[model samples]
Target: MGCKSCGSGTNEDGTPKGCGSKGACNTSSCNQRSTYDWLSDLGIDDPYAASIVEVSFKNGASKDFYYAPSELEVFTGDNVAVETKNGYNVGRITLSGELVRLQMKKKKVREEKVTESIIRRANTRDMERLAEVRDMERSTLVKARAIARSNHSKMKITDVEFQGDGKKATIYYTCDERVDFRELVRQFSHQFRIKIEMRQIGPRQESARLGGIGSCGRELCCSTWLSDFSSVNTAAARYQNIAINQAKLSGQCGRLKCCLNYELDTYMEALEVFPKKADKLRTEAGLAILIKTDIFKGIMYYTYKENRGLLYPIPVAKVHEILAMNKAGDKPIDLQSNQLVVEEKDDVFGYEDVTGAIELPAEKRRKKRRKKKSGTNAKGRSSGSGRKPASGDSRAKTGEAKTSNTGDKPAAGGETKEGSRSSKRRRGRSNNRNKKRGENASAGPKASSGGGDKPANKPSTPKPTGEGGKGGSSSSGRKKRTPRRKKRGGDAPKGD
Candidate 1:
């Protein structure tokens, strides 16, 4: 028979070996508390040593001490049938030898009160009966819950367990108030044909019996190693400076998480040196109110009453000094008088603030457009006596003309050459205009009167006309010749 405690198979003598009460498993996987019998390993000093043993039932949910007869030779992990009030009960031996004494003392169980004795190692028939009883527990639990609900009972049935003999069943439940299930038990016994026992438990005990995963992504402490439940409240959360949100603080048991108490002692010890009545500090500007306390860093945050939004962190010692000064009828000039200076640590990669240093390629495009607007205005004034197109005027017509002449498939090299020539012409016109304007200014009224009229007509530059004529003639010829080639090809086909 395989031991249910550790799930290990039969030992060499065909007896089951459970997780020995050594507080550890032989395989090192089971975390259920087991005792290591160092006395057995070192050899028992007396062969007739007191054979008081600890046995666990229902996989350690319940445990009790049993007297083992010396002649039976029972060991840890041996499934044994023990005597109970009704008939007999079966459990796996978890501890033996000198270790059982220490375990009893830890649990405050007296050896003389342990009247139960192991009858014999569970035989094949006994093991089979235990398996049958174990299968009935689930269905029994569901039916018991329905019975309780149908009868309008306030109790919540959490779990059910049947004795190995299949003679009795224990129903575990939780409720806010006491429930008298006297009639409910009569109905359950009639339905299941067994002795019914109702055991009332707390919410935490119910959660432990019905195991579940906690928010920490591990098995619940109540279900795993934590056997005792301590009172957890919002005070533990306040000491740790945790938010008082109920949903965040609650655990699987719908109570404040037990983990909140784990680190509370450390927080309390660190907060001891902080001043208690330093909630408000007097300053020349205004009264600074306490915002928060950083126990680890020994800093206290305070904000001016006039400007509650702005907070300044002051060292614990400095805050005490300021408070002492205020108590003595003197106030500091400002809350910042004892401000804490936090040193900046250099990053491993030498991090830099490049928020302002980022330069987008699109910004260069915007600058190019602005420069083009200014240049075009200057060119228009110099060439055509300031008769320039409005800024909103569409340049699409000229752009379309270029696109049509180029057939939208112009070579990249050809486009670059054309662009360079146009730029050169604009530069040349600008320079010539500049020279004329300077000469007019130096030559006074005579030069202006004589040259102004001539320059006005000279606005019709040969460079633009020459370039326009070339593009127009080439486009017109290409359009005219394409139809003639199609006509010639059509005529040849008809003649053939």
Candidate 2:
């Protein structure tokens, strides 16, 4: 089959470029045409050399060219004149002589004989003169712009350069519309007293001339290795699947970066391994279009109606088989016999039965038996050995019943009542005795400590006898009379 990528192009050696990932140019030694080789082509004359150097021209113009011998003659610091169609351009001789051939070939420029020209040596005068030319150029730019403004012109004097000979100064400017700057140039020549040349340049060219490093962290291609610029567009980005962010896509030249075109073929190659998004496929239940792909995982998914229109996953190889069958105008064969099966992988469910047979659930477990109590049982509470209530008395009953039925003290005044009354009478007498004793006890201590109170009666009062008037006059005196004696004897006997 014809190679499945971009159609054939010429190789480096002038052979036909093929379709696969590899595209080589038969003309060059290391003959591949690729991003890396594009850079590699700039350094050496023989196309086989790996490293390449790039060059950029004034006005944001740049190109990739093979390094040749004529370009490598001068050393890094030595000033050398670069041969140009207009004139010999003086610059620090970066690469010279033979290196130019390699740089040129790297750019894929057809080899041409070098122009027989000698870029002359630099001297002290040349250095000083070049500096003077630059100072003059700067000053001239200001005057040039002023002149243009005075003339009601919109042109801006962007740069000025003093010719190597110091005989002429070139003024570089840019304008939206073509400007008649003849008067501006004449005025500048008169002011600086030198020959004046006016040159118009574009924005990219301006950015290239005043170069800066790019986001890629390298010297700008326009200033270094590119010689010509081609119009770059959004399509270059599209082909590489890059987003069209202007700032990112544009280079230091304020134009699309030339590097955008470098890896396009690689991305194109990668896409081949993936399924074409345009082709629609039919499954058992529904029709499905190829919506997306994941090439690395080798996974393809098909949407079908019955499965809630959700995509079902199948391996890429399986999809390829299905595609082949469809392409051959044949129905898909049953894949169960020929299907490639992945081994059972995980313990989504746990351990299998160890006895090699399924076990049944245990029959309803038996209920346990209880031991009965020997005596009267109480309601609500579990009984152990129970005690019976005593008859005629309620205190011996269960704690709750006894508490509820018993009034203050056993009975008020029945038999138990009479006992309570007697107890109360004894308590009353005892209480009175206690009260008297308390008063006597309290008074006795205070009286003894404080001395007893004096009595109301006289101190000499006579003591009374049991049967007589006074003890001193005794019963004998009273017995003087016989009656009195008998009465006394009888009284004495009675006393005994």
Candidate 3:
């Protein structure tokens, strides 16, 4: 297997064997920033190529210029062991040949400052060690964070990197202000038992190093291709008519989104076409003031100074004409016009028309009316018990009616002087009707007969005990009630 940076290596049998489809995939990915060597692919070799090679560490997290040996022939995607002051580090070669010279010059890195050089190409053993160190980076980061915490250092550890030989580690941290590094480094070095590097970076740089998807649903520009970060301000949003909402306007860096400045120049150019000194227009109806501008549509929206609820859109040419008319001592009738109305699309395609179609019946609860307090009538007697009397008791019903007609007061000890009888137990409506009929029949005979005299057909009061259909001694607590006989026409009172 070889580094498949160029995607153009071969096998011994003359068949393609590199990272292409013709061969088995032996791609040891080294390309992170996606660079292509145009000269190498074209089979062109420059006689005056730079000796300095650009090596990327941590898959393009960082890049440093290293002097390449004249004798060593580096291939695409080749991993090289570079010389650091502490130990050797492994990195992939991203740039070589004269292009590297141009990169160095563009970065303004002087050749004399380039002190380190490539020792040799990464062999099997070096790669194995490189993998081992890379695996330890996560654990190393956790331990470094713990160490920094133990030291009470005011810094956030973002990432950790280990040398190929595992002899040194670089800890990337972020801090707002200067920190006391002497104590932190002493503790870290003793704890890890290796050379400790405290590298500081900004919040944006931290996000760039640790790549992630952005709010735009794509890879971060910083991690993908954007290398330079410039200042962004709210003026960019204002020029484009965007709302000044902090949450939507800011990116993951807690700063104004870089995309805000992408089309800012175009917006600025468009804004220049808007007329100046046209914030107000004098009219006979009232004074109208400019509210906003539609740069592309060439419309300027204005509102009456007294009525801001309605907006009137006037063409740029019409606005200029009005300004000229005003300058010539003339005034328009009013700001309102047919063009002031902005038509909005009434039909939305994606959503279902569910308005008033789905009805949910509201739950209705019947409120129980409060029962009026029962009290005695004008006479000093209880109308009924604390509840409703039996339906057959005609006397009790009459008393209750009289009690209600008069303002009854409560009796002593009882809940009220006369509590109206609400049904104490459940009873059938038929039973109540039958009881009322019996009460009517019994009342008719009683009313016809004389008041004090007993009726002839009525049964007499029982003696001590009546049995065997004859008057006799009664049994104790076991006597059965006799059924009432129906009244006959012959038994009717003579008065009727």
List, residue by residue over 411-443, the lDDT tens digit for candidate 1.
211221112334334433443445454422111
Alpha-carbon lDDT, every model:
0.67, 0.47, 0.67
**Lowest summed lDDT over 10 consecutive residues: which window, candidate 2?**
443-452
**lDDT tens digits by residue: candidate 2, 107-165:** 56554543434355455666565556656656667777787788888887777766655
TM agreement with the true structure for every prediction: 0.63, 0.44, 0.63
lDDT, candidate 3, at 56? 82
Q: Per-residue lDDT tens digits of candidate 3, residues 1-496?
A: 3333334456766534543222222332344443545555545667888888888887778889999988987744567899998779988777778778777777899999999999998887997898888899998788888887887888999998888899998889999999989888888898888998889998888888887878989877777667568889998898899999999998887778888989998888887867789999999878999888899888999889998998888988888888898999999888775244567999878988897899889899999855432333223332233343444332334354323334533222232222232321111122223334332221111111123232222222223334453322234434222223234554633321
Query: Which residue pairs collide, candidate 1?
Result: 18-77, 21-34, 21-35, 21-94, 22-34, 22-35, 22-36, 23-34, 23-35
Provide the lDDT at 327 for model 3: 97
Candidate 1: residue 117 lDDT (0-100) = 94
Candidate 2 stretches greater than 4 Å from native: 1-77, 80-90, 101-120, 154-156, 175-177, 217-219, 274-279, 285-496
Decoy 1 TM-score against native: 0.63
Query: Which 10-residue window in model 1 sums to the lowest lDDT?
Result: 442-451
